[model samples]
Target: MSVEPKMPKCWRKESKPHKFCPGCGHGLALKALGMAIDELGIQDKVVFGCDIGCSLLAWDFFDVDIVQTHHGRTTPVITGLKRANPDLIGIAYMGDGGGYAIGSQHLVNAATRNEKITAILVNNTNYGMTGGQMAPTTLPNQKTETSPYGRSIEETGYPTQGPEMVAAIARDEAYAARGTVANMRQLKGFFKKALQNQIDGNGFSFVEVLSTCPTNWRTDAKGTWKYLEEEMTKFFKVGEFKTPAAKGEQS
Candidate 1:
C-alpha cells in the first residue's frame, strides 16, 4: 500500500497536484507558507490575497479566505482588508513583476505607512505567466523575451533589492527578510516570523523569496538548481534584513 505525502492542514485537499509548472518554485514557497499557517494555528483568521502573474494560480491553493487581485494590486487589496478588519491577518502574495513593477507604488506607500499586513513576493527574475518578459528583478546579462540580447545594465539598471528596499523604508517595528525555495525550513521560519509580526500588531512585514522558473529559463533540472542556488544567490543575498526590536530595546 502507498501512503499519501504529508501536507499542511490548511492546504486544500482537492488542490493536490498543484497547477504550478514542473520545477517551478511557487509550489515550494506556498508549501512553506501553508506549514507556517498550520503551525501558527491562525488558519481561520487569515485572509490571503494573490496578484496577477503566476502567483494568481494560488487562488484556491489554501482553505482560507482568498482574494485574487489585478496585477500589482494585491498589496492595496490586502491593506484594505486589514484596515477594514484589524482582527484579520492579511497576506499579499505576488510575483516580482506585480510587486516591483506595476504594484511598486502600492508597496512603497504601504511600507511608508507601516501597514499591518504581510507581503510575500516570489522573485523568479521574469514575468513567468506573461511569456518570460524581462522584469524589474531580472538580473543584468540575463536573457528574456524582451531582453533577447541579454539585459544591459546601463539601460535597465540592476535588479530590484526588494527586501533591502522594504527594510530601509519600513518602520523599526516592521519585519523584512529574504528567503529561498532551496531552503524550505528557513523560508518557513521567515514566513512564521512575518505572520507573527502582523499578529502582534506590528508594522508591515515583507519577505522576498528567490524562486525557479525552468519553463521560462529554458533550463533542465540541473540548470534550474544552478540558477536558483548559485546564480540567483550571487545578487540576492538570503537573510533577515530587519526584525522587530524587543520591548524596551533600541531598534
Candidate 2:
C-alpha cells in the first residue's frame, strides 16, 4: 500500500495538478523547497524570484510573494531584493539554462560578494522549456535537440559544475551543495540546510538539484527516473561541496 506524501501548507492549493511534464523533476524540487519553507515557518517572509524556463511556472505555486524574471536575471533581482529588505528571505529558483549560461556571471559575482540569498538550481542537463537544447550543464556527448550527434566536449567545453565552482572560492562564506530529485530525503535535507543558512544570516547558500526532463528527453516516467539515478549522477557528483561550518560559522 502506498501512502500520501505530506504537503507543505505554504503551497497554493489552487495550483494543484501542476503543469510540469509527467516525468519532470521540477515538481519534486519545488515540493522539497516548499516543505522546507513550511518547516521553518517562513512562508510569509519569503520573496521567491523565478527565472525564465520551467522554473518560472513556480511564480504562482507558492503562497509567498513570487516574481518571474527574465532569463538568467533571477539572481540579481533576488540579491537586490534581499539587500533592500534584509528581513525578507530571498530565494532564486532557476533551471540549468538560466542558472549556468547567461546568468553564470551574476551567480559567481553574487557568491563572491557574499550575497545573503538562497539559490536553487535545477539541472536537467538539457534546456527543457526551450526544446531540449544543449545547456551549459548538459553532460558531455549527451544527445539533445541541438546536440543531435552528441555533445562534443572538444568544442563545447565541459559541463558546468555549479557547486564545485562556487565552493572553490576559499574566502567566500557561501554554502554550496548538490542533490538529486530522485533522492527525496537527501534533497530535502539539502534544501532545509540551504534555507536555514539564509535564516541564520549566512552570506549565500546554493543547492543544485539534478532533475529529469522526460517530455524534452522523450522518455517515460520510469525511464526518466532511471536516467536521473544512473546516468545523470555519473556526471554530476552529488554531495555537500561546502557548508557554513567550513567557514567557521554555524548554519
Candidates' lDDT values, in order? 0.97, 0.88
Report residue 118 deviation for candidate 1 (angstroms): 0.1
Q: What is the alpha-carbon lDDT of model 1 when measured against the actual structure?
A: 0.97
lDDT of 2 at 34: 84
- Model 2 agreement with the true structure over 1-251: per-residue lDDT tens digits: 98756677898878876888877888989988888888889988999999999888888988999999999999999999999999999999998888889898889898888888999999999988878999998888889999999999999988998999889862346689999997888888998998888888877899999998888778887888888999888889999999876455554
What's the C-alpha lDDT at position 20 in model 1? 96
The numbered model that scores best in lDDT is 1
Task: Give the range of the ten consecutive residues with the poorest summed lDDT in model 1.
Answer: 242-251
How does residue 65 of candidate 1 score in lDDT? Answer: 94
Model 1, stretches more than 4 Å misplaced? none
Local accuracy of candidate 1 as per-residue lDDT tens digits, 162-230:
999999999999999999999999999999999999999988999999999999999999999999999
